[model samples]
Structure formats: structure tokens, C-alpha cells
Target: MSDSSTLPPARLRPEAELARDALSAPVLARAARLARWADAGTRVDAGGGLVEEQLPAAAEQLGLSGDDAAAHASEAWRIAVDTGLVEITDEETGTVAAGEDLALLTGGSPQDVLGVWLTALEAVLADASVPDLDDLVDAMAEGGEVDLSSLDWDPEAESDFLDGVLGNLYLLTVGEEGPGEAPVPLPALAASVIVPSDMGEPSNEVLEQVSDAMMRLDDQFRLLEPVGLVEYQPVDEALMADADEEPAAPVDEADVTRYGMVRLTPLGLYGLRARLLDAGFEAPAVGDLSDKGADALLDGTAPFPPAAAHAETELWLAGRSPLDAARELLAAARGTDPGAPLRRLRCQQALSLVGAEAEPALREVLDDAELGGLARVWLTEHGARDVPPPPQEMVFWLTIDTVAAQLAAEGNSEELRALVEGLARQHSGFFDTVWRVEHPATPEVLEAMGRLHPDKKVAKEARKAAFKARSQQGG
Candidate 1:
């Protein structure tokens, strides 16, 4: 219930924990300075996006070249926006200004500052390295998850070309670590070599270009260390004896360069996870469930979106027997929590995926009114012999409950809205009949749709439908 700053150390310290691995002091200092300038009402040049022209002014102020100023502004602006030092209200209209969080950050601890900076690091990478990263991610994902390892090289040895640079260390954190293999060191030169518009194996010249890009990026990465997005060290303490000086490198390329194995740190892994979610990627959080049984899996996913929970359930059930999986799911759904209704809904979905094998276990609950509706739906959908239809009210209520469960999960409201609106249109007197249906969540779902539907008319209609449904129940 508390903010990250107020919470205890053992209770989910994502920012502090992640910042430990990266070099973040410089980034935090720059972000703080940018925030102070914003408090004085500074702008990133109101005319023509400012990097080419106004960067010189900023450079003179910061004692750097125009190009360095541009790079600093590019990174610092993104950090500011992400950490609430700067807020971009409208990208199209170019409306941006300092934010309320700037003052809070000014007084923040080093961990807090680096944590906020880490939060914005993903967006900074997207701006600098992968402009169309969003589209590429959409193309890369399959069955609600992204798997770079699954991709085949196209007659060129360009395996994980995008993944190497843009794929990031997030995958490394969540993915299966190879058995007995060392931390496969990815050097600085190997870090670059992007294809620009194409994906192919690199030539010697391409390696040089990629190496150059990595060198430039290494500068930014050094500033990133305290935030923990990436890690590099001197491999000796005396090398960086002066705390204010930039850390010295190994100075030899054959074994290690100034920047050591510059891969995504564990902290960077989670930072990327958050960033991916913000951009609408269904990044998986399937942590170490490889050894978990059906009971453990169901217990863990009780509150997950049905689609996400179903995917996890199937994975858990893959090595086990379907009937057994169904039994375990049904057992977990029998919890007495106030949230049991939605939990049962997700469990039923997983049971359905187990197919007709789950019917025998489901049928035992058919007479219990609370769970019988779900059982009836499963039996009817699975073509069980001699299964009689439930009352008209039960059918309608169950349909509404299914929609309610999806709404609870916050999955694809656009599709849900379209489906609900279509059903309302198909039945001309939708509200009249639906209001009379006896369902506990009918009013709640309708009210939610009223607020969530994009169209004013549809939203208003949903509100009216909810009022009528409430009145029918005399509420």
C-alpha cells in the first residue's frame, strides 16, 4: 500500500536492488541538474525540436560540444520525462513542461534517483537504438509471448541479430540458463553491428561499424551503471582510484576492453519487463515454475488474466495427465475468498483446455448453485451426453459472468466492448431482457462497461442498462 520509498527492504525493492549492478551516478547527477533547470522553466527549444540548434546553448552551459550536448539532452530529456522531471503532455503538439515529481526527485536519495533513472532507461534505449522496436516486437511475439531463440537464421548467420542489441538482457533473466555454461561474454564490439533496415550476417566492416556504435553507446552505459541496466568494471580498484574520474578500462581488446562484458544486468531485466508492459507487450513473468505442479500453478495464477492464466496452466499441465490437472484446478478453485467468483472463472477456462477429460470432476459441482453455472457451461460446451440446458436466466447470467471475468483481468477491452455492443445491437431490447436476468455481477459489469467504452453513446447506453439492471434487483 505504500510507495517504494516508504516500504521495508524485504518487501520488493526493485529499484534499489536493480541499481546495484549498473554505473548510475552520472545519470542521476545529470537528471537532477536537468530537473533543477526545469524548475526555472527551461525548455528543449520550442522551435524545430532543438537538438541541432539549441543544443549548442545547452553545451556552452554544460561545458561540452554541441554533439555531446545533443546526446546528453536526448538521454536527459527522456530520463526527465520518465522520472516526472519533465512531462510530455502531447507529442504531436509539442506540449511539454516540468512535472511535479521533479521536486520530489531533487530531495531523493541516491537509490531513489538511480531507480527513477532506471525506470526511464528503456525508453532512452528505444529512442537511441530501436526506433521501430514496438513494431518489431509485435512481429516477433507469438502465442502471447516472445521467443527470440525460436527464430531461424536466413541463409545468413545472423542469429538473434535484433535480440543481441535490442532483445536485451530481460530475456536472459527469465529464460532457461544453459547447463554448466559460463556467462557467455558479449564484448563491446559485438554489441553493435545493427542491420539498419535489414537483418543479415555481419561482414568485417559491419563488425567495425557495430564496434563503433558500441563504443559510443558505452559512454551512455557507463552513466547507466548505478541504475543497473548494464554493467562494466575496471577489474581493479587502483584503476579508478579517483572517485570523480571515469573508471579506467582493462585497456586491451584481445581479452577485455575499457568496458568489460557489457550485457544486460539482472536489474536491467526487470526494467525492460516494465517498459515492455507499458508498450502493450505481453511479456511473460513465468518465474521458475518448471518444477511446479498443477496445484502450485493454479494457486499462483488465481488472479491473472484468463488468457495469461490459461497459457500458464497449459504449460503446467503439459507433462501431467489432463484429468489430474483438471482435478487440481477444481480443488484450487474451491477457496473461500471474496474473490472466489473470478478465480473459479479462470479455473474453468483452464479446465476447458483440458477438454472433456475434466467433465467428470466438473459434474460433481453441478448441483451447487455457486459453481453449477460454470459446470453446466463446461458440460454443454464439451458435448456431454444427455446434458439438459440450464434455465434461461442461468445461461444469460453465465454469459455476463464470463465477460465480467475478462473485465476483471483487464485484457483487451476493445474486443470486449465490440462483442458486448454487437450483442446489444443483435437483441434490439437488450436492456429490457438483461435487466431481469438474475446475476450478482450484472450491475457491476454494466457500470464498468459504461465507464470504459470509448463511444459516448455506447457508454451512456451501458449506464442506462446498468440502472435498469439495478432497479430490477431492487437495488
Candidate 2:
């Protein structure tokens, strides 16, 4: 039979494509791990079906409880048996019958099982809507058994079959069982774009190739057209794919000597701006004139004239210049007067433009007593939403006051409610203090707090508070 077209498309990298096929590395890794674990001489005599005593031992070996192990093992056996990986003798026997071929064909170590699990994870990552690990765990805890027999698997396929199996498992685990909001799956196509190590200044060609690859993968996956390129360093180096051994020839400055300076394309600038936005950055202000102020600064080398500094600053903040020029302007503005409202604003704008390079300077200013408030606000706005606010006194007060004002000014109560709910869910520990002070204790507020609270006792406390507040208001 012809190769399955349903598998993800082949790699488009002209050079890399020839070096190796798009094998699921995670799957292979997981399977190999599991194989090693099973090889450690752990045997499950399913002749009398899966026994409770056998489960706890296996679970302990796997660093899990007996119930969890039994559940996972039973599910695995059921799936394997249905997929023809194992055989069953008696129809009445609920336990799996390990035929001679079972050990040789399917048996492996704990590491091997992990490899299998990861292989499945890789496949699930390809899809945008699959549930995450926590979701899967909860589903399993609810006694949901995965139906591996129903999945389409062909042993004869040329590509990695185990990878697909692991992918399905990963998907099943991450999927939501009830009609509730689920975790957003990071786009696979977006995930494929690799960032450089330095992240300072990649050659134009490298940037172009990455952008092109992103667009191509986006088309293949049918993902939403990204507003702009979002570049972030992997949290851990281990998360990154190993770089190719054969490196491309370094670009010489002499090669571009005849061309003078490289200018940023509008799209490139847009990508830069988007990247900043993704990092939680805001546009700097170049005075009152907006884009014009930025253009004037880009044209000349001198410090922005005081008369036009505000407009100029705003322009700088708006990210209107070539990347290098933008960087220079930002650095100069920061050096000139670090405390200038316009400077701070410009600094915020510049940090976003500079990407990770600005982290040190931003962090430094973030600790200054006078500058920290503005610096942190700007940083927090531009950085990851999950980043914790600075523990300083003024910053805390400013943030709380700002949030309160925002909640008060919100035009749509429904939207405000949702926003508040999300905030409370994410920072439930602060709910009693923040929510009560800023927002009136409505029935919706009580429900939202209760839903997001991890401890049942805390949720009960919140409900009681809401009830007391409501009763006092005679609602």
C-alpha cells in the first residue's frame, strides 16, 4: 500500500531534509526508555487476568500508586491486545494473556514505557486542540479507559508507528472531558521556528529562512495567521533541538561592504514589534507628534531636541526605524536621562525592540526605588503574563490601585467579570485581599472564586465572605 498521506508533511529544509527523515524523536526516546524499564525483569502474569497485588508493585516501580499503575497497565494491555500486540485466550478472562510473542514483541523497561509515552506526546502536539497532561490525569482519575483499539495504526507504515501511538496517548491525556475552558495548545507550526543562540543579531538570510519556514508550516497546519513573529528563548536548553553539526559559513562584513548598511523591512519591524508585544512590551512615546517624531530621530544623529522630544520619544516607542537604528536610539535615550518620563517610556519601547538583550538593563532599573515602579509596570506589561510582580511596596500599591481603577472604569460588566475571574483563578491566593477591595462581592464573583480555588476550604471561605457581604447589602 502507498504511504499514508494522513501523516504530517515531510520536512521542507532542503539540506536537513536529506540528512534525516522527520522521525518523532520524542516517541523513539520514550519507547527506548520503556523498553529499558521492562527489561529490568518485572513480569505481569495476566494468565488469571490483572491482579490487584501485581498492580501496586508495578506502580511502585513506576513511581506511582498501585491504583494508578493498575489503571495504566490495564489500559495499556487492553490497547495492546486490541492492536494485536498481545493475545487473549479465554473470552471470560478479564486479564490479559501474555503469549510467547508478547514478551518478545511488546515487553520493555520503564524507560521504554516513558519513550512510548513521549512518542505519543509528539503526535498529540501536532494537533492544536488536544488536551494537556493535567487534563489527561484527571480524566484517568475519573476511571476513563483509553480505547487504543479504535485508533488507526498500521504496523507496515514506513515512518515511526510507535510515535503515532504515543501521540494519541498524549492527545487523549490532554483533552477535556466536560464542556469547560481548556488549556490553549501552543501552535505546532509556531513551535517549529527555531531561535538563534545569541538572539542578538542573526543574519538576514537566517531570519528570512525562519520566517519562510513559519509561513510554510502555518499553511500546512492551517493555523490562524499570526499577527506577527513571536520569538522567545527556550526556558531550558534541553527543550531546544540540538543544532546541526555542520554549520553554515559565517557572513563576512566585507561581503556586505558594497551595500553599506542593512535597513529593516517594514515587515521585519512589524515582527520585532510583535515580538515585543509577545514579551509584554509597549510602544515608546516619541513626544506628542507620534510617527513623525520617530522619523526625524531616525533621520538625524543628535539627541532629540527638547521641544520635539516628546513626539520623538513617542515615535521611538512606536518602533518605526531599522532594527539597529531603533536599538541605538533606545540606548542613547536610556543613557541621556534614565528617569525622563519620556526616557522611561522610550526605554520600555526600546526593551521590547531589543528582545532578550534588554533583560539585564530592564532588570537593573526594575530594582531602583524611584524607577522600579514604572520600569516594572512596563516590563510586566511587556513580559510574560505569568511573571510575578515585584515585591516592592510602591509597585504593589501602584499595581493594586491601577487594577482597581481599571475594574471601575470597565464599560462591560460581563467582560470585566471574565477578566476578574481569570485574574482570581491565576492568583487565587490574593483573592480575599484584592478581589474584595477592588470588586463588589457579586454572586458571579463567589462562583468564579470557588471554581478556581485549589483548596475546598478556601473556596468555602470565599463563598461565606461573598454571602456575608451580599447579606449586609440586603441583596
Candidate 3:
């Protein structure tokens, strides 16, 4: 994935809810239990791993059973150590004690608990990137020290690959056009990072690579599920064959689960967003602007998806009196900057959520040049009696402002094209009157209409009008 600064915002669950999830995740819960269970009597190896003799006892403590029970206990112990749930009191003596952070699980704020969980997640991610124990043992059997080349695992590359996969998963979960909470097919996800975006058809070699990535991800997600990062359906066991051979093509739709399917849990979204922010990514969440001023709310949510923006604005408005919020929003919306049109658009959307109590604030702005048209429209829509019609200049100015806002927000979208066509068709001479509007975005809006309007002659009229507006502005 590219630098995460460009990633879309993730709508995360509340911190308190996610903190509860972190505490209940199988891996984290076991790790916490083991942390509480450990005492001065507990012993660790030089590496701070639970001593070999204690593995069975630890598994029993976690009530874990099966062939993988001991391995699970060991993984939990490692997490306990890595996240400071258990401290290595004496490295030389391999003595262990409950760590300071162990107290945070019960006493700290939700953010503090989540911070510990993030640390544990990072440790798990590092462990997931490592080659299998069997592979490691085979490599070491030759001379005791493992040969990395023999294992064919580049630690950095493996780590980066997992990060890329997780990043792609994050995108799928949060992108406006993504699958949202629906489980992504494993084959599709593996291909996302393997197949070139510009490539029309994947080569045979590329397909093989994708297949290999799927198997690796199957293992990784299995490990990750215990940590509450993903809800995963593992690749079907029947599908596994010789590692060297490729399976047949065209997996049936019904058999998609045979390859695997995965979705990030809500907790996973919180965890990944935290990681992205730590890496200097500008990852925004819905309520991030709740405590901020109206100007921040309008400017900040300008780039958000409609639903996210509404959710954010709703939260921002929830704290203040509707009248106060309306006044603040109206004051912030009055600007001549390039971004001001979208700010006004956002303000209008936010005002729709305000009750009739904000009528006074709207009435106060009804005569202001920049705000009068929207105020009149809002008052009329709310059934305020005797709301006067906006003057022709105000109507045309608002039209230019609205079109400019749409262009900035949607970028010549299908809806905008339809809008441009409708505007030209509805008015006898739209371009002729629109060019004379005093709005700062008049020329730009006209130019966009010239490009978006499908009628050739109407499009020419819009371009001519835009040129006239530019010349008038220069004069």
C-alpha cells in the first residue's frame, strides 16, 4: 500500500466498546490471565519465554486443549511479555512478575487499555511474518544456526507483505465503494496485492503468486483471528495439496469459501486505524471533530463521504444549542476562499439536522449577501410564514455556488453531468445570466458546466460565458 496519508477515513466503533473487545479477545484475555497468574515463582528462558516445563500448566490455566493448546499458551505468554503485561524482573535469573501495565486492564481509561492491545497486536503481527517452526527447525538441523536463504524468507519482505495485505483490507473496509463489512474472498484479496493494477490479464506466474499469497494469508489470518483482528473462514482443508502444484482455475461462486473469506472486525478497524495514525497517516474518524469548533467541523468533513460527514456533523451539533450551532456554522460559511463553497454546502447539510429552534439564526442571515439565498430556501422548506423570495441575483449566485461545491465534491460525477444538463435545459439562457453572478467560483463553475453539459451547442455557450466571466473579473 502507498503512504497511508492518502487512505480514506475509517468509521470506528467507540473506544469503550473496542476496549471491551480487546479485553475479551481470546489471545488478549489469555495473556492477561497468565500475567495475573505469574509470580516470583514463575521462570522464563533467556529470551523471556515461559520455560518449557510450564507450557502444559499455562495451557491448563487458559483451559485450552487440543494439539495446538501448548502453542496457543506459548503465544499468549509471548504477548503477555511483549505488551508489558508481565515484566522480566531479572533477565539473568529469568524471573518474572506482573507488569505495571497489568493494572491498566482494570483501572485505566479505555484508551490506555487499547494502547496495550495495540502493542500486543504489533507483537502478533511480527510473529505472523516469521517462517513456520517446522521450516525453522529444518533449516537449523543442518548446523544448529538457521539459514535464512534456505528458508527463502526475507523477514522485511514478509513483514511488508503482511502490512500491505492489512492496508488493503483496511481500504476495503472503509472505502466508499468497498465491500464494507462483507467478507472479502481470499482469492480476490490475494490478487489485490499480487496482480498489477494496470495489467489487463494476469499471467500464469502472477496467478501462481496469488495462490501462494492466499495460503500464506490463510495462516496469518488464522493466527490473527484469536487476537480479534479478523473474522475469517479458513481456506478449506480439502483444497490443500502439494505446495509445488497449482490448483485448477475458475473457482465456482458457491466454492468461494473453499478459498477463504475474511473481514476486519470492528476492533480490527480501531487497531489498524491506530497503527496508521502512529505511522503519521492522517486517519480521520467520524467523531474526531465533535469537540472542535464549527469551522473545523465544516472544513474537516469537507472531504468525507456523505454518510460520514452527516454522522460527524450530527455529533458536532449534538453538543451545542441548535441556534448556537447554526450561528457558528453560518459565520464559518461566509468566506471567499476556494474551499468556502463546500463549507457552505456542508453547513447547509448540517443545518438540515437542526430543529426549528434555529429559525432565528437563519432569519438573521436572510439579508446577508453570501448567505441570504440558502437562508431563504431553508426558511421556506421549514414552512416559516412569509419568507420572502430571494432576489434574482441571490438565486443566480447560489446556483453558481452550489454548482462549484458539487464540482469540488464530486468532480464531474454522473449526477453533476445530469445537473449541468438540467440547468441548461431549465433556464432559457442559463450561461447568459450565470456569468454575471458576483460569486468567486462563477467562471470555474461555468467552465465545469462547459465540460459536463452533453449538448454541444449548450456546452459552447457555457465556455463562451466562462471566458466573459474571466474577462470581467480581470477588468
On lDDT, the leading prediction is 3
TM-score quality measure for candidate 3: 0.95
How do the residues 211-231 of candidate 2 rate in per-residue lDDT, one tens digit apiece? 443333323222111111111
Per-residue C-alpha lDDT of model 3 across residues 204-263, encoded as one tens digit per residue: 889889988988998999989988999999987776676666453345888887888999
Q: What is the TM-score of each candidate against the true structure?
A: 0.41, 0.20, 0.95
Clashes of 3: 0
Every candidate's CA RMSD: 20.1, 26.9, 2.0
* Minimal lDDT window, size 10, model 3: 242-251
Which residue pairs overlap in candidate 1's backbone? Answer: 22-225, 22-226, 23-225, 23-226, 24-225, 24-226, 193-210
Q: Candidate 1, which segments miss by more than 4 Å at Cα?
A: 1-299, 302-311, 318-320, 334-338, 380-383, 436-438, 452-461, 468-475
lDDT, residue 375, candidate 1? 79
Residue-level lDDT of model 1, residues 1-475, one tens digit each, is: 1111111001113454444433344555565565555433344444324345545555455455644566675565556666676675555555566677665554656476555665566445444343233545755765766544544323123323433453434444343331111232344324433544465665666655654445435444555564455665523335447756543223366656434455555555656555555655555464334358655665566555444465566667786677777777777765444455567777776777886767778777776655677877778878888776677666566667767766665555787778676666676666666766666778877887677677788778879989988887789
Candidate 2 TM-score over all chains jointly: 0.20
Clashing pairs in 3: none
| Cα deviation of 50, candidate 1, in Å | 50
